[model samples]
Target: MINRTVIVGRLVADPELRYTPNGIASCKFRVAVNRPFKNEGEQQADFISCVAWRKQAENLANFMKKGNLIGLEGRIQTGSYEGQDGKKIYTTDVVADSIQFLEPRNSTGSTQNTPNYQSSTNTGGMYQGSSQGQYGGNTQPNYSRVDEDPFANSKGPIEVSEDDLPFD
Candidate 1:
């Protein structure tokens, strides 16, 4: 049997983190996912219950809060327990294997001190060039800081050799 699910949505509320008797960390939260279709010119969203464990759970509780955007990959879990009324209460939730923050830490407009974390899955090659210095320093020169283009004074077409071509 195969059971997998992926969701990208905003959190409904802050994650609730707790430790078990064994000292294992766990967190429970809800995500509000907007439906693609609209009904009566109004968009509807589904509140999905989710749970995360261990370091992921800790990270979620510490760094994420209500109204934050997030993406998660997990599997559906279902269980039932006896309620106080002597009735079985069925429960369903997504067991989060990985949770990703979908926005910058400062975007929420809060002045709290928090580390700026970017999704490693989509860094846009920010750390690609070099292994030295902070954030994988780029080997390329600081061209963006230049006030004017170096080629702006050139009077004619620049000449290039066939050997300079990177590809055919």
Candidate 2:
């Protein structure tokens, strides 16, 4: 059975990062994904609860913020917990394995309802989508092979007047 899910959306707020007793990193955040179709001629959105574990969780909290567009890939997870009312509440969320930043263009900016999340590290920053889409930490990207150089022969060597180079 396929339980994997992928989604792209803006974060509703900043991610909250925490560490367990074993120092294992984790974070939880919600992304506001716009629907492909508008709702009643207005923008429709779906908020997804996502959790990142280990390094990915740390990285997300380190570099992601509210209002940023992000991509997520994970599995649907369901768990039950006892509420304060002594009732068992069942919850579902995405167990995020990979997350990519897609919008608002920063690590920390414009997050709504940001109360349940904060990073021990930098609270403000931006996240860029990686080629491998690895979560947390830095990954060396594979550069595409380019056959030609962009600046090889644009212009011949010409003696520039003192004013042309703008060194003055």
TM-score of each: 0.66, 0.63
Tens-digit lDDT track for model 2 on 44-91? 888999887776787787777777767777778888999999999999
Alpha carbon lDDT at 70, candidate 2: 72
lDDT of each: 0.73, 0.67
Query: So what's the TM-score on candidate 2?
Result: 0.63
Q: Estimate, for each residue in 56-121, the C-alpha lDDT of model 1 and write its tens digit.
A: 788888888888888887778898999999999999999775677776654552333442443322
Off by over 4 Å in 2: 103-168
Best by lDDT: 1
* Worst 10 contiguous positions by lDDT, candidate 1: 118-127
